[model samples]
Target: MTNMLLAVVVGLTAGAALRPAVVALAIPAGRPADCPACSPRPAGPTVLRLLSSGCENCRGQLLDAPWWLPPAATAAAFAAVAAGDATGWYAAAQYWIAFLGTALLLVDSAVQRLPDALTAPAAVGTLVLLAGAAAEGEPGSLPRAVAVAVAAGVLFTAFALGSMGLGDAKLAVSLGALLGWRSWQAAWAGLVLAFTLGALFAVFLLLVQRRSRKSTLALGPALIIGTLAVLATGP
Candidate 1:
């Protein structure tokens, strides 16, 4: 319990403290894009403000983010593995996997899109990280993670090929981390939740003018939400 609390504290503090830096990084340092999310009274404060705060690219939209969210997710993964059949290192890996998903979803949603720059590296990095984790710990889990990565990666890749952007497949790598070698329940639930949300988002577009009749919904956010939901439900 104490460790969980500490994790929560660290996650919250890091998220909040990092916000200014993130926003600062978003902007080009000199120009302002007139975003609706900003304070109108400021009348175009330096782009530095938004970039440092992670606000320029919709980073500010994460205002309601639970500070300890990542830590809590990590704790849950840890608990599941310790009490259930999963190994400790595998559980640790999933904690990060869940974090990456959740983080990407919010960031992409706020920006109204996901950049391939982010997704491409993430997909590759996740594979490398998982491979390393498997190598360092249990050997069998590596193969299982690989299978999960291929299955999930291909599924999302096919979806992107059919109707979405390529980033969707890259985002699937995150799900692979959570669902790999886990019970079938985790895999199915996460996948179901992601697509269900994606479909619902499409309907939402029709109801509101936020999106066009033909504009495709971003899959990064959907996958992120789905992964988080699965993580919360535990194995």
Candidate 2:
């Protein structure tokens, strides 16, 4: 219970801190990347601002983030702590994914695009943390993790030729490594669940008349959700 509470607090804090970056990066392509809220400001004040009423400069100019990010991030962290490996390193890896995955989901849902700024760092951070886990007596094969990541990237690249984007492909690399660290079956399950959830989401959107058959849906959130679900439920 204590650990869970700690995880929730950490998630809330981190998620709040991430709001500025989310507003900054969720812009449409070809637009200026500057965040009116935190641009030219140091990290300390930016984070502090998030804890308060947000930035004053970009009142309505920036993306209005959903109000549920902190709760969502808290859920992610709790899930990681509850279901992740006993070794602190593996739990840390899960927390990293949960944190960044929540941000990616929000950004993609809003803009229908995933920025390289988030995806690239997520990929690197997951890999590095997994390496730390391997060194600390975790029961996963780093080589297998790398191989699965490569294969997932290749496979998703093919999917990108269709409704998916290169951003999804890049995000897959990190998710694949995380799942593959468990087992091949977990990796396969995550992929299958992602597509299934995505299809279900599309159907829901259509039923509500929010999107048409030809409309491009954002799949990043589904992918992130599916990966997190598998991680939470997997042994």
Candidate 3:
């Protein structure tokens, strides 16, 4: 119970700390082409303020963030505990995974782009952490994770060729690694759920917002949410 509390605390801290990065990713580069007279805001200062919670320049802008941001971190802490991983290292890894996942989800939702910086590190780091977990008496799962990563990457690559962005495909690799670390079933379900949710959301936008079938939409949040759901509902 104490460990779970600690995990929640850590998750919340990391989430808060990384909020700036998410905000930075969401902000557009330079001034709008039509508003050349407006001074361009560098992402660095905004990031610093967002992290410190003190930048007047960024405080108002931060209001654009979804209300779920803080709760998602707390939920990830509960998920880490629910995974039945009692070790400190696993707990720490869980916190980081959830933190990074939330960041990716928020950034992608805002900008329709997932930065490689977050996705790449998340992929490599998750694999490493799961590898360590497997080393500590768990076995056969790491190979499954790698295999699922490859398979998910291939499937998403196909989507990227047509409907989805390559960044979303890359995001799949990380989510797949995490889900596949648990079981092949988890990996399969996560992938299915992600696309299902994304498709449903696209349909919703089309129906309600009058968006076209070819309208741009961010899919990363759905993918992240689905993966997190599967993680929380452990095998």
TM-score of each: 0.65, 0.84, 0.80
Number of the top candidate by lDDT?
2
Q: Residues 88-185, candidate 1, lDDT per residue (tens digit)?
A: 55555554554444445555555445556456655666667667666676534556656777788788777776777666777776567556656556
TM-score of 2: 0.84
RMSD value for candidate 2? 4.4
lDDT of 3: 0.70
Worst 10 residues of 3 by lDDT: 30-39
lDDT at residue 122 of model 3 (Cα atoms): 84
Off by over 4 Å in 1: 17-51, 54-87, 136-140, 208-212
Q: Compose the digit string of candidate 3's lDDT tens values, residues 68-157.
A: 575565457455545655354444455556777787877777778888888888888878887787778553377888888888889889
Candidate whose TM-score is highest: 2
Q: Where is the poorest 10-residue window by lDDT in model 2?
A: 44-53
What are the candidates' C-alpha RMSDs? 6.0, 4.4, 3.8
lDDT agreement with native, every candidate: 0.57, 0.78, 0.70
